[model samples]
Target chain A: MDSRKKEGQMKTNDILEKKSTRRSFMKKLSIAAAAGSAGLVTGGCVGGSGSTEEMGLKWEEYFKKNYRMMTDKEKDETVARLEKLAKLQDDANIQMSNQEPREKVLFGYAFNISRCKGYMDCVEACVQENNLDRNSKTQYIRIFEMDSGQQDPTSGDGKYHHEVPVENKYYMGIQCFHCENAPCIKACPTKATWREPDGIVVVDYDWCIGCRYCMAACPFWGRRFNWGEPEVPKEELNPKQHYLGNRKRMKGVMEKCTFCVQRTRQGKLPACAEACPTGSRVFGNLLDPDSEIRYVLKHKKVFRFKEELGTDPKFWYFMD
Target chain B: MKKIFLRSGLFCLCFVPGAVFLAGLPAMASGGGVMERIHHAEEPYDSMAIETAYQQPVKTVRAKESWQGGTFRVLTRKDSITRFRCSVCHTDKKVLVKDGALFTHDDIVMNHGKGENGLVCIQCHDEDNRDFLSDSSGKKIDFDHSYQLCGQCHFRQKRDWLGGAHGKRDAYWAGERVVRNCTSCHSPHSPAFKTKMPETYSLPLDQ
Candidate 1:
């Protein structure tokens, strides 16, 4: 009878040991999952949970101030954080423009409204060029076709589709005018929106406090604010990047047309101008009287948008 | 002495009317005629404006000296008046017999009447519609000879022409192909190209 009791006791002990082993395995798995999620959030392998306020403190601080006032160390840290956030959103490789002083490179664009055919080729090109987040709202250029004999540019319709050479319609493509005297720049108390020396107006994604003052100030209605994390696929991301232009902006920042400064600064034309079949969008030195813009102004009866307003817009239009 | 007095009286009568016309005043047609009919419909000042605006310059060719080799052309006042009249191109004196005949052209004539009765060059070739060119040899060339010259007045049509969206060309895909001039579809004198549509020639699809 003692021998029988001893055997039963041995079986019970085996069952208990197996149960203990299963519990330990489950605990390890839970810990590993928690560690992975924390890594994704912090970009570090160390596992821990932090409150939203604690996690976003650095980003919030960076966003609160102007980029011009940021120290060299702060700027580097901000850029690094942005890069990490971009990578976390998409595993795709990102190449950021290493241009220093980042403020001096100004870019500008002038489109000939007379030549635009409402082809939407530039719209498609921008989507591919910037690797826009497909799920969210993003549009680089909005072309509106006004009725014949109508002087008001705002009187046109936006949706159009068909073959080339659509008649009796005057197409006005509205994008970032990158004005020399941008009201948005003046309105931004934080100086988030500033003009570069090359004539491109840009927004510091990290420095923008989401005040939306720039959006209100823009006369052309060119600014777009990201409401959520931009969801872009990794493969389609453009590795060629620029600091002031399309380097994959973050959530809650205001963005607008930069005249494709990244490409223009590198001696290349804007992607929209390149994709245009009719060569409507003319990009060149406004300072150079010998440029195509100069020829257009000299030969054609060029008119600007709201000329009475004296915005001194670089964009010019003439009858074809 | 009697003959000289009569000539002087006639000269005075003509001079007074001519002076009035030059001073931005419409010349009163003798016996209340067609000029009066048209003038009555328009404002008096506007009629004068139109008459003054329509005044033409005379053409004169001066004989050149032996050293100069070529004669220089200058316009005289009487010649300018004649050039301004419809008789400049339609030299047939009978055609300009009626005073109102100078203003008639194919597009302007309201009534067709009988065959070719309404056709006139002045009808279509108004100040806004006139487009002409002079060749190197001093020959007046029509729109057919130079399409671009015709485009100056017709800005919208010219744009289509340059973009290859209007006018007929030799091929579809190949860009390097001969294209027809404006005169192929339009006559400068008539300027009503649409009138020749369908009846004169059908498009390729219609054919």
Candidate 2:
């Protein structure tokens, strides 16, 4: 009781100490009015550059809160606006998703180095599934052709044009490993890139400032930057898209693999894993002890690409 | 608190209508024919989210042995084979001649175990039953349970496959754990992948 009375007294005293006079309040109001009017004049001038609908949408998009901070209604509105804009620009019917991560699911991937014969079917499937820009040659998966005795992946040639599974040559596939302690997230000046609750790292293209800090910070060169406007052939564009995964990205923003969020969130394998003919790529929830990934981790002689860096990449590699 | 509430009520009364009016003005001014607002009906979030994708009419068989205290299911092999029901032809009780001529299965290369002490067809196939495969002990095995025959020699791979470490699973990661059988990928005649050019290679540095 005594402490409550003292708290009340302190609050009253604090209010009394910082009380504003009518004159000062009026002065502050006048200053605010002046600033608001100046802003209105400049805003009107900028609004003249576009159609009325475009201006309205641009203003709403500019003022919309960050994806994490947005309410469900706000996310809906953002999706509506983006979809409408896509229709206006390309005359393409695209569905942009705002799927929340599922519960009790942390995705993990396993690749068999012995089984992967550098087929590159996965790279082709990734291109079609993600609607990646064709002119830019944006490939998410790279199959490195390494000598059988080599320990490092980067020492191999990824550009071999001849027949695959050459004598004394083995294949190692690499993509965004979606590290647990993601350095790219830390390097983003804006919190544009973040790891999802399901352990898939994603980037908000709209929020990225194109600073390329995340790219520079990534150890594996996992991130890709758009130098100019990204172009996908109209007929080749994937109609199904996730706002964070394969949605149409503009110039300057960065994109990386989200483990095919559009499909994976709906309980399907990533396109690369599905397209692999040799049954090499295995994907499943890491939390499930009975999952294929867990089985591989337990029974096989598995190793991560870079275990010493402490990135704790979800991707693992094993030989038969 | 009363004053604050009254003030907020007054502010809402003054501003909400104005905001609503501004929001609706664009639709009216542009007329109805300009842009059709695409309605995205909100769907209830599904926890498993696998029902739509689990489309296969899978015929699963329980594994004879559990992998890790948990029994799993494997897709059956007989349904998808092109020329199944081998009893349609080999019905007669006759000892099959060692093949030097091509007759029914000319397409099959019979290249498996081609090195030392090469395997013959009758080693795996039961001449008496015609439809069933047999282990070295001549135990009759159904076509669906061909893994038992394969496991006699390749036991390590069979164990890995049973444990979900070595085979392709169904499209879903969260539903009934259905995996493909060994014969689904590997031909019983030959099981090695031949050398071939990669489908696509866009090496940025090389270009």
Candidate 3:
């Protein structure tokens, strides 16, 4: 009875402390805001930022909440700011939409080990489709050529440029696996990274502090860090972009494949899958048991690169 | 970092849409029905979004292959090279044309079906009808459905192809699934994928 009484008192005391702090914050907010604004105004009058409106916008942008936490009004304001800035900087009028995940539509991928010829057609297609940084040599998809009787990824070389379909050799391609237990998301100190409803791990480029911790966490070497200012030529930029995806990424941020969120969410096959001449890559909805991915899993001897690690990757590979 | 990611997004949005609109201007201005091509570009997205019968992919058909006397060329469905129809030369008499001395198909070069595999032209091609292909059972098959002719001996590959385990699917991931014909990717004669250079965006090394 004494212990329960003590616990109840402690709970009430904790509530009281929270309430007192909140009350104090409310009480001092307007006064402090007014003082700060007045000080800025006076300073501006005596030679400060020529336009207070620009100053206010900068403040609003800096203080905006996380992408997932923002209210509808906040989202609109932020979008407008982005549009105005894009226009001012690049003279481009782009539409970056936030597409919600479709209901019962979890994405998965599969690749035929026997079919891939290391043609690298998928890599070229991905770069063209995603508007990757041309100057940074940013390539999302890499086709690795393996020797005779070898299926291990570590032994494969993506940089091989010789005439392909080498005798007794095979090829396989790698990209973001979109694991169910994403280590990259967990490694982020800020809440800048998260998995979407469709299980695509995404980073809020705007919110990221560029700490590079997430890069260290990924075992698949999935995420790429922007070490230099990305320089995509004006003519090469793809205008169709999703806010969380292939939108023009900023310097010092991290980015990975979202399974072509802008295209796939609208029901188009990802560029890599579409460009494959040999049809090595197979993609479909995991929720739908009738999907081709499920068929490959059930009928073929499918294996993943890192199954023993317990990441539960949605991507699978099989050879006939 | 006290940095600005939105400011960058703003920059991106500004330039990207403007760039797209500029590209669209040329596309819109082109004469002689450029609209159809533009429509075709958007077809994958539109067709994929259409609510239709989710046909579980894969369909089985028997396959067959025939010998041609010339170079390995994937026999196409158009059959544009055919000069004369079956009725043009073939008639009531069971006669060999030109006394069986290199009278027709002078370009054909048979590299496959050697020794025990040595096959006569009529083995798969209909003896009486030039247009119709024949199976081992002497089943008269349409030239348009020649995949059935190739399936006669390659029954295992045919099974794999029909199960969506061995072939390519169409670009549109959902909706109607259209698979490529065997001859589209493979030469009917050689039946082996040719080695080629990998497509490169930019080489990392000069070598």
Candidate 4:
């Protein structure tokens, strides 16, 4: 862990060096442009009287290094900038977390197929907790209502609107599995997505180049791309945010479930698990032999979704 | 010769279960059931075997039932109950709702058991002592620990709940292993869940 952090610092220094060189070049260009367009500059200065601070913050954010490559100081600065931006735009005070994953803790999930009654309480909780885009209806978790004979979740219907737990049917939820050998990481051209030490696969949203390659490469259909500006109502916004998990995203970037890193990193259950009315979901440290997840894995007749794909997903499904 | 024989015996004893344990792991990872083998290789069922390992401190109430072995903490129940202290109205006598004498529990419809001869209020509730519930043998049980009454017939769910597979747990995963009691999700009178519309449904194209 120490060596990995050191490597991150070294990479950050390299990026900082490059950023300074780029900054000088941009500065020269801006100076030349300003000199060339003196009349326009005076008009812009007059027109943008109270917006210089916001522009400066945006400029710094554009030049910020990737989350994984940032030093402690840089991380703090970025978080503060985001908080300031939130206050400026929405007038909503939000606390964004950059809490690192805990040691010796590999988070895993277990879903009891028989128990889920298809009420979709978890879907509601996840959308609210993550401050998902309201207009587009971006949801991290999808509960599929599977027929009695069919075991495959993909074959089931996720758009069922009528009264749920329809006779002769069961429900199974699917989300980002946070696979051990995540193909999305390999597909990323910019190294935006990577698995943390504690087994959570997270995307550094700023670094994602809107390529959508990770989305294509993911077998589980786990990644979601922002085609337009993601919007959340001011009152419904989840003020507690995480850099890699649930922080607001701009247009053209990709986002997925991060197991509620903002909450889970603080030892809380993911919002979906906590909101499950039927007690179908279980989340815990896989490393802990005595965890409820471990107990389920040990005793229950369990199977991973798409185990044949060799993704080695941390999520499992079991029947009572 | 004696020492060699003892070493061989010890190795055989250790290696047999160790081999079985290692074999069970891949089966678990691959999503296969080798439960019969696991039972043979490990110690007998102990409900309290799992230990709590959390970074943050958690608030929990100790379960009072012997089936739980007091291994885990359950979330506090009494505070959440809307009409606690059943003895408030029935002081020392059976208080029956005659006609329309301002009934407090008029909306409670008992749909728990099957058929016309299904579970009645007196079967689970003590008429003489409204403060407590009665089990099959008519043992007085506090309302807070109502699982003891529910578990009498639904032993399978009780077992799964004890093993952490059937019931809902507290918000935090790491902290003191606190779990919700049976009554938290299920109404004691009508345990079965009613069908309801989903809170939010995503676009079909998004899937």
Candidate 5:
């Protein structure tokens, strides 16, 4: 009821925002006209009828409220819009959802450095499972092959092109740590990035501006800026998507791993964890005492990559 | 008006089921002769062995299933164990395989553990039981129950497995916990993992 009242007030504010959005919309339309697409608007003739390309980029797209503060109705509208946009652009039937996290389940992940063979299967699994931007090769997972007796992960080469499980050396993978005290959340000016109840930090993609503040703030180089419209082959596209997670990302937005929110929320393992052939990646609910992640933290000598920064990363690393 | 419709629908629905139930009430209360016969056939035997509920492995992937492609899978112990049953060759006098008995497996190179020289096939595979494996305690365990035999030696790994630290748990995380046996990854004959290129998606250029 409170949100509905707030939304009503926002609807009044939307008219104020629309006047400004109209100026930008005019500029974009003029640019479209110069590019020989003048027929799109002029041919419509009638009001709000059959304005092909112009109708898709209406004033509502610009005036939509920030996701976190939006009402449930607004969220549903946003999800529907995103699904329609995906179908129009990619010809892919994507399910963009606003799925809530499982109750009492705070996710934690741990990987054994010793066990990782630099197989990079996790990276592949993450790409396919998440439906990440293929054209930009935007991989959220990066496995670092650290030299033997070297503790520094930054020095480790992620670009190594050799047969792995190198003798005397070990491999360590890094992704969005989903920190409890996340810096990316602080850097997102629009309140687009926020940690879910399950400790998986997610981005409201529609709300995010082109500003790369979150990418700049992230210590582990976790975030990826989409340079152009992310190109995923229609055949290879993963239909299962979450609006705040792995839905088809638009251009000029910063994206990172959400620990496979669509899968994890439904009592399934993260793609990377499921694909680890070495049994190195362990994932479970941190709130559940009997969970594997808790066992790893309690029993194993686990440490986060950037422990000094005090990000309090939910993800951990250990050597067995 | 809504209440009237709901009430009429409920009344109709209740009568439909109630009428059918009333018609069958006498027959059900009297009981079927077939059920009585089935109850009588269920004999109680105090001397009968109390067999445990069989734990069927519902997982698709197993240790043996992921082993090899064409010839290697056929030649592996999983197939040979069933084909050339140990009891077929090893009778009254024979305890283990002699020279030519294992000559078919000339390509076999045992390099699993450091104590491979002292180890014989019968130590892990039960000499008496043809179909089952045995732990150090001489417990007759089914082939599916390889974890019991494996847990005897690799206690730390076993502990981790039980704690959900080591080994792969299949499909989903929340439901029934179904994990892989030791053989799902490690080869019984030669346990070392072969080094190779990663899957195509994670190549340097792709990154």
Candidate 6:
């Protein structure tokens, strides 16, 4: 019995020694994992590989920097920093042009709602034409189809798709109704969003301090604020960049439809107007009386959007 | 052994019904039913020969009218024949024959070639031309439908309607929608463009 007790004690001692060794090994492994994570965070290789300058900025500071206020040298450095930050966020080398001047042009659009077939082709085309971050919830056109007998024009919603030629439905396409007396322009203290000579409303992306006052001031709900940096694949990116439209925008900035000004200023129609299968949308100089739009106004009964607000929007609607 | 024999007997019982079902398949495939007989009976009209025979003498017509001093006059007949015309497809039950002789002469002179096979209205419009009867709602059954009546000669336009390329609907406002019929935009006899003025025509408020 004494020998058996000694043997049991020896076995106990051996088991305790083995357990202590395992515990020490586990402690060392945990310390190494923690140190490695700290290194990754400090080296700017975590979540996104954004530059130290961009990474250190607070969300508020990111919103407040006005691109226009910076000198040429400052702008160049800032653009380079932003490009590096974008690469880190995407984990892919992205080519970003901070030197490209914003191309501003006068542009307008008119929708004859009576002719729209609610095909959603314009909505799809806009998504393709502009390399919108698929995950970043940005949309340029919102089509609304209200019940046929709804007096309120706002009742029409465009977010729909089904069979070809839907019956008993009227389609109303809504985009940034660039107002002549834009309240968004008034709200922007930095003058980031402003009206142009050709009646187009433009945004100076760099100058915008991301004060969402412009978004609140827009009466038509036309503006969209980017919550995160836009993520577009390299292949899908619209390489032919424009200042007023189709330029990739960063996070925390306000964007609205530019009426495809990048395409229109080059003597081409807007993407939405071109994609319409039925000639429901007529686009031309409101100044030219001989234009099809003029003919429609002269012969057919026509009305502008929200005329009572006195914003003097360029968009118009008419019946066949 | 007894249980195995009983299970086999039960299998045969199920197989007999299934075999009977299979045996009936040939009869079903032969289509020995009333629907098949009726379909087979409709063979003659399905023949190309009969279709050509019916089409050969039918007249083709095109007519236009011009308005002058609140009155309209027939311009000219593009083609002229005196038999089996538009009246072959359309019956003249509700004839607007006020002065029968003058009407027939003017119609024949103006729309003689306007029918299917260059036949005049009088050729089929007469009492004996009774084969092309239409299922109409009215007492005398003049034409099948307003569009069908027009379709007898305007075949292409009729095909377009079936293909959903052409039709008329009411003007839709923000809340209220209304559809206007074909006759609202066209005149049967004159075939002239009509200027559409609203029911309560008012000058623009700005004007």
The best candidate by TM-score is 4
Listed in order, each prediction's TM-score against the native is 0.49, 0.78, 0.69, 0.80, 0.72, 0.46
Best by DockQ: 4
lDDT of 2 by residue, B1-207 (tens): 999999999999999999989986643332121011101112222324566456656787876767556566677888886777888766555544664243357777787885885678898999788789999999998888788999999999998898777878866666666777888778887878877998987474322
lDDT of 6 by residue, B1-207 (tens): 999999999999999999999986543343232122222332111111212122222222221211111111111122222343555544656555575654354552333344565543333332444423232222221321334445566666444333212232111100111112233334444443322211111111111
With candidate 5 superimposed using the best TM-score fit, by how many Å does residue B76's alpha carbon deviate from the native? Answer: 18
Query: What C-alpha lDDT values do all the predictions have?
Result: 0.53, 0.78, 0.67, 0.78, 0.69, 0.51
DockQ of 5: 0.13
RMSD of each: 31.3, 16.6, 17.6, 10.3, 19.2, 30.0
Give the runs in model 6 whose Cα sits over 4 Å from its true position: A1-106, A151-153, A157-161, B1-207
Q: What share of the true interface contacts does each candidate keep?
A: 0.00, 0.49, 0.32, 0.48, 0.35, 0.00
Model 4 bad stretches (over 4 Å): A1-50, B1-60, B65-70, B92-104, B205-207
For model 2, how does the per-residue alpha-carbon lDDT over A1-320 read when each residue is reduced to its tens digit? 23323433543443245346534765796688677766865777787654556656765776565576578999989988988878866788999889888865678899999888898999999999998888888988888898888868668788888987888888988889898767798798767888776778999888899999988888777888888888899999999999888998889989999999999988888999888888999998776666778778778999888777756688889988
| TM-score of decoy 4 | 0.80
Give the range where candidate 2 chain A is weakest over 10 consecutive residues by summed lDDT.
A1-10
Better-scoring candidate (TM-score), 4 or 5: 4
Top of the candidates by lDDT: 4
User: Which lDDT tens digits does candidate 3 get at residues A203-308?
Assistant: 7888788898887887777777787778777777777777778877888988878888877776667889878878788887665555566567667888888777
Candidate 2 CAPRI classification by DockQ: incorrect
The TM-score obtained by chain A of candidate 5 when compared with the true chain A: 0.82
Q: Name model 1 segments beyond 4 Å from true.
A: A1-65, A70-89, A100-108, B1-207
- For model 2 the local lDDT of residue B70 reads 58
Clashes of each: 12, 0, 26, 1, 1, 29
TM-score of chain A of 6: 0.68
lDDT against true structure, model 6: 0.51
| DockQ of each model vs. true complex | 0.01, 0.20, 0.13, 0.23, 0.13, 0.01
TM-score of 3: 0.69
Those runs of model 2 whose alpha carbons end farther than 4 Å from true positions after fitting are A1-55, B1-53, B57-67, B93-103, B202-207
By TM-score, is 5 or 6 better?
5
Q: Which stretches of candidate 5 lie over 4 Å from their true place?
A: A1-62, B1-109, B115-118, B200-207
Put down candidate 4 lDDT per residue, A252-289, tens digits, no spaces: 99999999999888878899999988999998777665
